[model samples]
Target: MPKMVFIETDGTRREVDAPLGLSILEVARRHDIDLEGACEGSLACSTCHVVVAPEWYDLLPDAQEDEEDMLDLAFGLTKTSRLGCQIRITPELDGLTVKLPGAK
Candidate 1:
């Protein structure tokens, strides 16, 4: 199992042991973490935007042009930002940490 940390906009943090290959969005939704998936992981909405904790940013693949474009519309954009649906969990991301931006 891969472990992931989610820091909510209200400052609440939760840890979950996720199955491999699950998207970050999937993990969040499974734990009822309140992440909005307006586009249902279709790469059409910025509601699922989240910031990868600095230390773990390099652990995931870079965002693609579509994800990047969507991220540009997200609130509280940061250098470590990524679309949760675009990040597939892997063993290397066992300790991944992410911050949920204030909802738009």
Candidate 2:
């Protein structure tokens, strides 16, 4: 099983199992992490926004236009911002790390 790290809003680092094929949002939900995927991976909202660690950001596939549009509405967006639902776990992304944006 591959592993991934999630940096919570308070800066806690959590490493959790990331089953292949599951989206980052799914991984967060599985671990009880506080990622509010309001649209349930439908790409309809920005509630599942996550800032990918700079080191791991380029490893992800580029965001499609729709995801980019939704990300525009995300709070605390960053250069590496991504919608957690749009990224799926793969062998190349075994140690992915993302930061939960602070709440509004």
User: Which is the leading candidate under TM-score?
Assistant: 2
Estimate the lDDT of model 2. Answer: 0.95
lDDT tens digits by residue: candidate 1, 45-79? 99989988989998788889999999999989999
Residue pair clashes in candidate 1: none
TM-score of each: 0.95, 0.97
Winner by lDDT: 2
* Model 2 alpha-carbon drift over 4 Å, by segment: none
**What is candidate 1's CA lDDT for residue 53?**
90
Question: How would you encode candidate 2's per-residue C-alpha lDDT over 8-99 as one tens digit per residue?
Answer: 98889999999999999999999999999999999999999999999999999999999999999999999999999999999999999999
- Model 2 residue 89 lDDT score: 100
